[model samples]
Target: MTTYSTGGEAVVEALKTHGLTTVFGLPGVQNDWLYNAFYDARDRFRVIHTRHEQGAGYMALGHTLATGKPSVCNVVPGPGALNAGAALATAYGLNAKMLFLTGQIPQKMIGREMGTLHEVPDQPGTLRSLTKHYDRITHPAEAGAKIAAAVRAMNTGRPRPAALEVPMDVLQQRAPIPAQAPVSEPEEEPVDAEGIDRAVSVLAGARRPMIFVANGAQDVPEEVTRLAELLQAPVVGYRTGRGIVDSRHPLSCFLPEARPLWDETDVIIALGASARSALQGWGKGGRSLIRIDVDNTVHGRYGQPEVAITGRLESHLPLFIAELEKKGIRGEDLAEVMPAIHADWKERSSVLDQQIRYLAVIREALGEDGIFVDELTQIGFASRILLPVHRPRTFLSTGYMGTLGYGFPTALGAKVAKPDTRVLSVTGDGGFMFAATELATAVQHGIGLVTVLFNNSQYGNVQQMQRDLYGGKVIATDLQNPDFERFVTSFGAHYGRASSPEELAPRLEEAFESGLPAVVEVVVGDMISVDRFR
Candidate 1:
């Protein structure tokens, strides 16, 4: 049956049909009709009005990461779309599932060069560069199908960001609404038999094997743990792959101490992990390698692999474990070696007393279920090894993008998605300022989040780099921060300050338990260089 409906109503109906319950965005002139439709349907949808387009987009990204469900971000044309681009890039880098809904100039004015409000030379092209797919709704009738297609793109193989642009005229125009078919996602392909056999044979012959799990392998945490146990190999997770195996497991190793084991291992199993700089190009070669990933292009990009298995980790891991068990291959117990590794790490931490102590406090406060949103900072990198993440998706970072202002907004998104779970965002003073305005959004929405701002009164990362590389000359690295306590209190939120390491734990505990948006500013010294580790 066909029914008369405005393009705005069609878009709203499409989103609702596709199971979009929450949307984050700001209102603007070009997108007024769409916003009206959302407002009319307010009872059915929860709209979170953010202070900026960037925060809205990031909140959408954070929501997806915490719930493993696709999220939506709506924005106006031109400037609004541009403002949201940063968060879109972050989502793309992390391979997160997000749908960006943008308003465009009327169809007639699209390429007229008539100086329309919020007009860009080629808006679709601009959005295409940031998302996996970009499409336009030329007519009101096409809104449902196009929105469905965008949602499908976000949910399909190797999930990524997608955008849909609707012209202002089309949104306001009336057209007959057609009944739309339900969105159906394509099934993932099964693991190849030959690839599975090769992986089994390689593992069967290996003596000292190591499994490196990446974010791509997040879905198969139990299988990864089983495989690690069966192979008796040390398991190491990098980036998004952090909690693939319980970090507390005796065989589960931290990245800092796992380097020595990498040198001794005869075979390496790289699962859903990219060979980024952090892994030092997958470490000095010469080891038998088995690489598993859904993306085929990632294979042999860094290190030559003996076998490349292309499929979802959830599907391939169980098969690999079954084959290994059939062959009677079991991993050696490393109960004795774990303690020595811990001792070495403790000795190394003696020089970073304050940083270590602050991290210890955060770890104790967050416990196992708390979500930690990390920004690029000295302490951020340190927590990768010092903190123990027992569950998947509990630790969120900017991934390969290394975005600085991402922590606070992303934490807000996570809290919105998982309200029952406690969320904390740890950021450097310089990075926190990028999204500091989000404090209002947090307080307004009652999104209780604990932000631990490490204030060294400078851009510590670059400051240290300049000292090491440029004759100890520091340029453009110093920062003058506000009184953090008063600043947070002005927004009707709780605030705490820790001038020294001893005050960190109690202050953080108080702020986190305050049941409001809070900030804990911990005064710290300049970052120590990696040369200290050597």
Candidate 2:
């Protein structure tokens, strides 16, 4: 069935076919026709208009990170696209599934550099650099195919962002909709038998094995847990990889807690984890490495693994477990010794007393199912090792990108994805100001995101670095912030204040109880830095 429709209508249809009903975007003249189409189909779609392009991009990223499903982000040309570049780059680093849509100058005006509206020297080049797949829809007839191709690019292969650029003229033009079926996400690759055999041979003989997991292993928590139990190996995750195996599990360990064990381990199973710092920084200590991942390029990228299996862990782990079962091979369970290790770790990490105390309050308030978004703040730094994440995707970080100011907006998107679950963003005074305007977006959309703003009135991390490393000379680190209560209340959002962890707990409880977009400000003085642990 073919029907005449505008390019914008075709693009929206392509997105709807993929079951993407929500769009995080900021409309402009270049995307006027697209917004018009969105308005026409208002009942079928929910457009979360943002105050800035970066907010739109990060929110889309948050949605995907929380749900492990692709989301859409639409922006205007040139500056709009450039503003969202950081989020796109972060998405690329984190392997997020995001489809980026942007408008171009008039098709005829492109490449001529006629000083036209929203023109840049080479916009397509920018998009190509940030995304794994990018294309331009030259005509109205190409809109559907281009959008569909972008979706396929994101869903298949190494799960990165994809982009498409459409000219305003093309968006306004009408053409017959092509008869095309919706693209299905490709299946995870089958296991490599030879690779699996080599891995099993190494694992069956090893007395002490360890498992390291990252974002790639997030979906196969049960499989990873089973494999870890079979080997009686401790599973360790850092940052974005947290909660793959519940922190409460005896076999589960945080990055810092696994450091001492790394010395005793003879074999390591790097499951969908880069283990870059462990292999490169910590030195392997002659451990036999076995890596299982979907991206084959990681085989020798960090260090040459003794055995490398390229496939999804969900497909490869069961085979390893079955092979170990056949051999009747099982390592000593660490449950008996884990309690002592946990106590020692707690005593050793007391240097971070303030951070741990604050985090405890937050953890209690957030509960088990809530999502916690981390920022590049001092507390956020400690959280990588100090926080106990009980479920997958419950802790969202910027991965290796270490992006600042992504927490609040990303938390909004997480709340949008799981409205019934509590979502909290932990940010510093300096970082929260970046996307603070998104408070309006939350209030207007009724997002119900609760933000915990740690107000030290300075970029605490940078100041500490400057004082310790640069001989007590600090510049451009001190921040003069507004009265947070007034600032938040002015936007018609709820606000609470706390000066200590004891006070923060009740404040957070009240904020959550309100069931509205709220900001809880925590006032603190200078505290110890956690850089040594990192």
Q: TM-score, each model? A: 0.96, 0.98
Question: 453, model 2: CA deviation in Å?
Answer: 0.5
TM-score of candidate 2 against the unseen true structure: 0.98
lDDT of 2 by residue, 1-534 (tens): 888989888888878888889999999998998998999989999999999999999999999999999988899999999999899999999999989899999999999978999999899899888899999987767777777788888877678999899899988999998865678667667778888889888877798898889999889999999888888999989997899999998888888888778778999889999988677768887899999988899989988899988887777888888888888889887877678778778888999999999999999998998899999998888899999999999999999998899888888888989999999999999999999999999999999999999999999999988999999999999999999999999989999999999999999999999988999999988889877765
Off by over 4 Å in 2: none
Model 1 is weakest, by summed lDDT over 10 consecutive residues, at 275-284
> In terms of TM-score, which candidate is strongest?
2
Measured by lDDT, the strongest candidate is 2
The lDDT per prediction is 0.85, 0.89
How many Å off is the CA of 187 in candidate 2?
4.2
lDDT of 1 by residue, 392-459 (tens): 99989888898878889999999999888889999999999988989999999999999999898999
lDDT of 1 at 15: 88
